[model samples]
Target: MISRRLGSIAIGLALLGGTGANALLAPSAEADATTSRTYESLKNGSFEADAGWSSFAQGAGTEAAVSDLRASHGQRSLRIVDSSSSSAVGWASNAIRVDPGKQYTATALSYVASGHAPLLYLKFYDSAGRELDSTATSASTQRGEWRAFPAVSAWAPDGATHAQVVIYSLSNRTGTFFVDAVDLAPGANASLTANQYFHVQNDGSATPWGWYELDDARQAGSVVPDPTDAANGVLAIRPHVSTGDEWSGAVGTRFSASEAARYSLSMKALRQRGTPVMHAALRYYDRHGEVIGTDRSGIDVVPGRWQESSLTSLAPSGTVEAELIIGCTGTVRCDTLVDDVTVTPHWDTTFYAAPSALGSADGSTPESAADYRDDAFWQEVDAALETGTARVVLTDGQYDVATDDDALHLRGIGSDDHRLLVSGESRFGVVLTQRADLTTYVVQVRDVVNLTVENIHLTADGTYVTPSAFLITEDPTAGERTEGIIVRGISLTDMPGVKYSGVGVAGTVPSGPGVVDVVVDDGLFARGGSGAGYHHVYATRGATTVRVSESVLQDSAGTYVKLRDNVGDWVIEDNIFVSSGTWINNVQFIQWALYNTTEPGNEFFSPGPYRIAGNVFEAQEGWCAPQCRVMTLTARGYNPVDHDGVEWDHLLDPVKREILMDESEGNIETRRAVVRQNFNLALDDAHGISVTDNEYRNIDTLMTLWNTSDYGAPSQGGNGVYDLSNLFATYRDGL
Candidate 1:
């Protein structure tokens, strides 16, 4: 007998007349169209028989079927197939119409009654009997247990356009089985929105739903919001401080905002005190949740009263959304109250440029404005110096000069804001030359003292080599002391071609002992010619009490900072030393030779003691030759060397040394030097130095007395040497 079925509508044909039948044709056009067409369940139900398993059943306004197929719980039902098979041979199957060359997801929910096979197979075939794609599942089934088996497959029927699923049962056959509740759906997957917030419920006794308290600068209240409700609920949030300690609101969503527009956000805040200033910051974020813009405002918070504050700023380029933060670091009394938060676009209207002055070089002076190389400016400056009231101001533009004489000889007159740029590229020689010939310049006290030079940037190209850059040589025949010269915020670079010092200042040769007090601050000294024997920045003889601070010196072969003989009372602080080389060396801080020989007293030495503080020393190995001595301090005098005169203090003591390194040891070699308190001396890479009051930890060699002027090894007196108190001899192999 031959049988055919179209879903739940089946047709059976029994070959009752002949044994040799060529073909049994049931020419029913309705059957052909119905069997070829696919059926999708619009409702949900169970299957009572094998034939019924292939039919679509509807229940409770939902489509369902029975073939051991099910959908994810709480999800909309689509299509399903169920199988009822207790043994391997008695497995049931189902057929469904599907589009050719399309993909579909089929799921099966089932459980074994009594047996456990290693695996189960699911096969697919076309209406003409060609195989498509096959899948399998592990075969450990329990009776009446339901499980969902999902398989995603693509159908490529050669010519036929429909496909069906076949279930292969295990070998053992036993109890009866039933299939129910299957589904199949279209489309890929779904995603959540940007502003969506999720919360998990914890069963409790208080309110049936989870709730917390809110305590901020502006207000104190309890939070009670339903987790199931997506809107109108308060969320617990924490704040972060980027610059100062203050609390502010955080952004809840990431929304794209245009860059060509401006955004302003307003919020209300309150404080506990009468009135206090609170910092409110609006931060912009991009699509990936990165901060891009920050707008800040100071809000006044009144006690128990809410005040509104608005912050405005241009929208950042490519900014989508941003968070707003409010905080206060002054006191806890300052609290931020936020309500009715609003964001909007900015609208404004006006623009203009300032008017230019007549006969003034408004940054439009040509490169050939003034002949810097000529002796004209300096000649006028020198003549004005005789009357003692000379001041030169060169505004914004470049100045060219070609002079064989002193560029600007300011005897007692001061020069400021004048970028005395010497640019002839070919006429390379000394830039500025100062002398102490008169008592004033421009009728304003020139040579007697008190001269100031500020806001000057000097540059020289290394294209040519000459005598020097700038020389401040005084005449000893004047029989007067030249003092008080403040040079602030000046930059000198690329003039390796000149000889002498890049910027030199020296006093009278032997004119009753000359004294020059100078201050050089915030300058950049770099790169000159090699073998020219040129130091980047130098101080010549008879210059005392010079302070050089907040400057950068780098990229030269010669010494970066140098002090000649008779120079004293120096403060070198807050400077960065880069490009490996000797930083400062040679010449004593306090030399007795210049005390009685040149001047009446030791005004030639640094005025009293000097200090070198807060400077960073960085060296690149093998590029520039490293200095053997990082810093050298000496007191070459016949007087008794005490803590009051020419004394060096090492700031790193035992505790400090231990904090800086795992271990250290050494005694610094300096005259009247005091090692600061709390430093560990007996650590690796801290040996062979001299410092006062250093702690030694498991150090094998306590002290090495070599070439000591006082005494030999075991009896060197007044030497700051402290041995390890708790000795561990077993680990003393390498010390």
Candidate 2:
């Protein structure tokens, strides 16, 4: 049976029956004292099965089975009609049977009615039957409609039994295809809170009763569950948004609440027109998902009118649980439509809290530790985060935060494994010799809302100056600051061990309609973060949607993540940017700017389109500074006054000297980028970027000035060059 179910979960995963059948399919012991368990085994997942499933087609197609047509939930579907335009495997399925090594996950709810399936397998077989490992997902996981495909794994290797799903259909557009519901489980940990406890459901989380959907086919074009349609039952989902696509749409439900001050939600949106918008937001997370705040429901969604929209967000000051979201955007097709939803609580407990910060009663522990982190532990954590869902637990020591009050308040209370730590008197760490720079900030996260700071390790000899050491943006006297901040697995070392500057995480831009979403993952930003010449992780003016992933921005000295006069939405991926030391260009540790600072739309350089993927750069050829030009976008008159009379804020930076005190009023060059795949690199002085498929081992300069100079040198201009596909493995001097 698929090699006795891959002999039990792929004995070490290599195409199938993994890890000796997942250690002989371990789970027993009454399913580990049960807290959650679901082997699933397809009950027709959500298509509500009729024929359980048994389709086949092999080489050219004509048709297959199970079809009630349109469905991502409830109704029924599994159609496949490859009228053979040529190549084909069309469709195949004979599913069920997996446990060996136990780690399973296979899901499908795809939707693309006519033509499409440039490959969509999911195989597994063994036991005199060979083919033990397989997983494919093509057409870049499009979203013309129904979505939810991204999860495919197969470790049932050794003598692995059987499980299948084909559907290749090479061309002829691939012909008509549509699969629905289809899940094989066993692998719970979906963040257990007693498992699927979603509420406010009128059918919102359709699919099979549980809930999950996080679209991003290059930015929302589909989310699913709308199988066809519904406003309150039977089914409903589809959070698309376009402008062609950009971080796409959203559909949420994560639950848990507290730390209130406006967090209502009501949903039922609509849109075919009316400018496109379907929002009813609420993000606020923690326990490492970060995002401490995001609120909407300022209601929008008009056209086709289903109305009922109602939002209220603004829940910082220690928010508890969150994730409501239903966002959608605009421009391209828009289609926005969300359904029946309601949420309310925090009827104003007069900002309730305090009683050992509300400990016990199930927020698990915290009856009193006294050293909660200090400043009265944030005043009983801002009064137990003002009611409902609150928790605090950290035990190890070294916390000396005497609270200079950067406003991470807290107390709104919670219990989903929240934590806080500062650690012993720089014990040999923060040396100013213990008076430790009296606290300008080794950590300061303003406003607050679902903050998550995991696995900390601090160090700051940032020699009293740049509030280095993990300090995120905006506190302009509170006014709606901070937004879901998260700095994971940190390690800031100093005295050259690796590095740590005063700007491990310091973003500015937050005054005038706020926006912030900092996610510095897998952290380790060595060489004095944000201190020496600044930028291990820095942001200015537009700090919206900043996501520095799989981190490791070494020897910082001249930009490593600097966004000035910012706008937002940047995703610098799988990093490892190491340059011995040199700045003023070339190894320009990620920098983006328009007029340097001053956000609120229009004036050009509007935030992003940046998506510098899979990195591992070593853009050598050092000796930065003077006449600098390895990487720089100094438009708006590239000479804000060359060193002459140098007070120009050392060459402008108060938002570019306020756009150079209104340099004849004009600026907005909208930055854009998408430098792909990596390994060794040098994408210098790159403007309006776009360079695909890379493999630049090390210098000779890959691309130096794509958008060439500014012509007049003021905002965007002439051939800043765009478009350049499949960058035939590089070793270059020009584009």
Candidate 3:
């Protein structure tokens, strides 16, 4: 026998979207396609309960029990109080069952007694009787009123065909539990939308998104959301500029689109004050986050209004996934509001041509495109050269030249994209030389003044005995000054056993300060014979103000870059010199001298100012050779003895012999040289030279003054002695 007590009650109802109070019914098994239902219930007193279920009060004995309610007219009254007892306890014999592989929502009409709270506990079990998940509802009201208690739970079934749903009381206090109009059913379809809700702030304090912003703008915002709703939200951004700041921002949209699909994006922007520059960019990234496709366009925005900008281009090859970024960068103070973002995919119909090949200029020659003498293509270039407006493009391939005086020349024309491949073993490679003194090769332009020379290979089979593989000469008699000459992105190699210099650029006297602003970037100069004795690449007289940066000069017998007396204001930066036989013993790697100036009177006179910074001079581990000197200033030709009766001002201070040893101050001596911050020298062998402020790191001996000539003893004023700051030594070691 069991008895139940009366508990507390609370009631409230929320109308969903002004719908009627039509209760939802349990969905039928055949209604599995759509999990939604509606129903209505009538009030009745014919409550019903199955046999073997019992209820009782906690203080009452088992004999005193409550009776089960019976159903009448399809309705029943779930009595809260069968007896006026302190606490109610109830139990059912059989477990409630549910179907597997389905989700159900259960609700009950329940109320509790006054001063007694009632909580609903729901326990779910698998078909194998294992508990999956359990939850409890909040305490109901203690008022004496009937209320609808809607409790819903979702369950996923395993392999079992049946599951149990147990509903029980969680509190041990005295209360009445009334339940009626119970219903269980499945849930509806689940779908999600894509929206850009996240913000990316560009504060200009770090790299990445922040770095993309203008220096003046404090920050920018971006958002990323689910892909489904990606087409819904507007990517709105504001580009603001202060008095001393720049405005910039980049917004990137990531997606996986078809490789062959042509996509375009259009943006509408509103500007506030100054002229605004906005750019729309499309970029594709692979799984490794490498850029595979990129298209960009920009528009200027007028003050006080809105403007529209659009960019369209063919997606890069093999781009399966890509990111579309809109960037705003400029000094104008303006706000750009973007909207109406859309992506339309189309089929591509454009044809792609493979890169052109490199060959010789002789017609009717039976040779491969890579061969130096493929006359068909060379004739095309020669014809274009005659017009002075043809572009000769050489793709990355090997070309062999098999003639003595068969030179490759582009004279008095606007030719571009000339590439000479000079790497790897070959039966014979091309030798590109200037046949006429007035000829010049025009490479691609970079950074407004620099030019690009694609790979140039100068290889020769073991038979031909040539003096030089490639040469550029300017005759003073002709009075020609080749201005804006740049040789970048070319690999030049001299074949083994070549006696002459591999490449030479020589200028004759007085074409008015001759070749100016010559640059060589990203090139490899390797393998020349010792008999050349000058340079793998030599810049002779009148080649002024040259820069050799970002190149590797290795495995050469002579100097890498040699500039004579006429070359001034030269810069050799960020270059790697490895396995070179020996530099010019007479002149330093960088030299300055006043030609024909007498010593004593011309001691302070320097031929030119050359800055040799950020270069690495390394010796191969077991190679025994003298370490390279930074610079050698020669006063040999212009000494006081050679001049007439005029005494040269001693630039070398007799009082500061240690500082005057290398005369490094002369390089920066006049304060005209900008040697503020740089790494200049490093050598394995320690010669007795005082390397002043150029910091040396991890060196065993910081500064050694070798006693070649007994200028003094090992003391402060002694010439052979060395005084070094530990700070200078530690700094050099780190480098």
Q: What C-alpha lDDT do the candidate models reach, one value each?
A: 0.36, 0.43, 0.38
lDDT, residue 86, model 2: 58
Candidate 1's displacement at residue 666, Å, is 9.2
Better of 2 and 3 by TM-score: 3
Q: What order do you get sorting by lDDT, best first?
A: 2, 3, 1
Best by lDDT: 2
Q: Model 3 TM-score?
A: 0.42
Q: Please provide, for model 3 over 1-735, each residue's C-alpha lDDT reduced to its tens digit, 9 standing for 90 to 100.
A: 112222331010110011111111211121001011111111011122111122323244212222244311112334443233333443211223333333455455555544354444344454444455544454456466656564656543332222222224433444555554343434332111011222222233212221133222423333222232233233445455434323255444355443323565655665554556666666776434677867777777675554666555555544446655554655554445554443444222211111223243222222323333334444454344332222233433323343332344323322222211112221112223222222222111211111123334444444244555555454455444444455644545434444444555555544434555566664556555544354656666666656776555655655456655446456676554554223222212333333433223222222334555444333332232343333333333322321244443222223444443432424324211111111112222122112232211111222222211111211234222222212233223343
Better of 1 and 3 by TM-score: 3
Residue 630 displacement in candidate 3 (angstroms): 4.4
Ranking by TM-score: 3, 1, 2
Clashes of each: 90, 94, 65
lDDT of 3 at 164: 23
Candidate of highest TM-score: 3
Q: Least lDDT summed over 10 consecutive residues: which range in candidate 2?
A: 30-39
**Cα RMSDs of all predictions?**
32.5, 26.8, 31.3
Which is the better candidate, 1 or 2, if ranked by TM-score?
A: 1
lDDT by residue for model 2 (342-441), tens: 5553222122112223443232343424433335455555455444333343433343433344222332222222222222221111211112443455
As a TM-score, model 1 comes out at 0.32
**Candidate 1: where is the Cα deviation over 4 Å?**
1-391, 412-448, 479-481, 529-533, 580-607, 624-628, 634-735
